[model samples]
Target: MLSANEIEQVYWLADSLGEPGQRIDDGLFLARVAMHARELPRNLRRFLADFRASNRSPACLVLGYPVDEVRMGPSPTACNRLREKTIDEIRLEIAAILISSCLGDVFGWRLQHEGSIIHDLAPRPEHEDVGLGTGSRQHINWHTEDSFHPYRADYVGLFCVRNSHRVATTIGALDPDQLSKRHRRLLSAPLFTFRPDPSYLMSKAHPLPGTDRGGILFGDPENLCLRFDQDYIDWPDDIDGIAEAVETLRRVIEASLIHMPLRSGDFLLLNNRRAVHGRPAFTPTYRGTDRWLKRINITRNLERSRRRRQSDFDRVIYV
Candidate 1:
């Protein structure tokens, strides 16, 4: 949470941008935000440092940030049309980017949400169960964000613009200590594959074809990373044990899942590789008063995805 003084500082910095809805390069925007980060209160800086380096937890919540009341209009019902941004939205996105820069560099994908650097999370009636953010009524089963892609985010950041209904976001982490030796061994094997979600295919004319294949868990046993999507993964027909193990894992996660409802001014950061997040079924009023949230993906290193990138200037991954 930022203090009133800190909030004023942020507002001043955002106002210095001169105009609302102006497009800024990622490098320039990050540099400007980083410069002002030094002015942040001591406790806020320490919290950002500790949270970015910590390995024990997969998610954390921040409270008490300030949101503009008059400028922020009703929530939109779609993710496309990225040119529109309100004064409040601009300030919120800048604030979010500052916090995320502590974790890593933020990025986008060409085949996801129209290559939006900052994506919207609003209920779209036409797509309620399409494996996308707009799927509000259908249970958005737990899965690592962009689990189908090799260049998935290292950290996922979300800022709640408005959530009057208190829509809860569910999250769960994998603990190696609880898994049996056999289950761990099976999960570490390269027997699992995840197909790209439907939303990615819809973003392109002729989408790339291929499934992401890898182990479900990786790294040290004490602190492992997970890559699983209940709706996207599939195992070999002959490998019945893997299937059973996955089902058991699913039940275990459900039993230990935590529900976090983000209110106005609430910001959350989740380790994308180590945690799975989802949302339960909810009714959307479709009236401009529906719940709204802004989201972005971050990576610790940009060079790791160079091969998948189209050009040096283009940050959005194509493959």
Candidate 2:
């Protein structure tokens, strides 16, 4: 949580960006945000630095930031959101970018939202029962985000622009003690498969590294790292005890499920590799009033992940 003065400082910085949409692809935009990030409250900066250093937990929550609700107007519908969005709606994005830049380099996918650096999470009427960030009538299965990709985000940053419904974001991490020795070995072996998420398959992009069979767990003890997707994995019944092991893993994760109901001005940085996240079903009002959030993906380094892009300034990956 930020003090009154700290909150004011954040707004001051966001205001300077002035309709950040124009600067999303420019190097200056990131540089300026990094500058803003450096000047964040000393305590907040320390906390972010620590969060980046530690791999123990799956989440870090920062609260009491500022949102320009009055100027933002109604929550945008999925159909014309981008067509009518104004400067006020993007102020929160600038703030989110600034704070997230403190942890790592921000990035986005070419196939997702046409390479927009910031993404939106809001319910769409047509996809109420579908498995998407825009769905509101079905439970989104918990999984490591973009689990199929090798270049997946190191952290998933979500900023609650306006969540009147108080929807809960599901969170769970493996606890080594909860698993039996046999199950740990089973899950650690390379016997699982993951399919790319639907959002990434909207358009025909280049053939990227296909998610061949891989282990669910990583690291020496195999408890610290995990890659899982309940809906997108291919089930191979040939492997012995694979089904039982997965079932056991599911039970353990369910037992540790943590539901976080975020409010406006809340920013949550979720460690994509260390934890799995999803959300429960909620009813949405079509009156331009629904739970809304600004989202971004960040990686540890820029140059390391920069590959196959058209130019150095282009952050979106085509492959």
lDDT of each: 0.77, 0.80
Angstrom error of the Cα, residue 190, model 2: value is 1.9
Number of backbone-clashing residue pairs for each candidate, in the order shown:
0, 0
lDDT of 2 at 71: 73
Q: What TM-score does prediction 1 earn?
A: 0.92
Give per-model CA RMSD: 2.1, 2.2
Q: Clash pairs of candidate 2?
A: none
For 1-319, candidate 2 gives per-residue lDDT tens digits of: 8889988888777777766355554556776777778877888889999988887788899898867666777776663424555676666777888899988888777777667778778888887887888778888999998998878888999898888778999999888667788888888887788788777765466564456577787776844588889888865798888889888888898888999988888999998878889999999886766988778899887777677556676677665
lDDT (10s digit) by residue, model 1, range 1-319: 7788766775676666526766643555666665666665567668877877885678877666787644777787876555577777777777777667777777788776676667888888888666568768887888898887888898898888888899999999877777788888888788888888877777554556479888888777767788888888888878657877787777777777999888988888898877789888888898877878888888888779887776554567766
Show model 2 residue runs off by greater than 4 Å: 19-21, 25-27, 79-84, 204-209, 220-223
Task: Name the candidate that leads on lDDT.
Answer: 2
The TM-scores, one per candidate, come to 0.92, 0.92
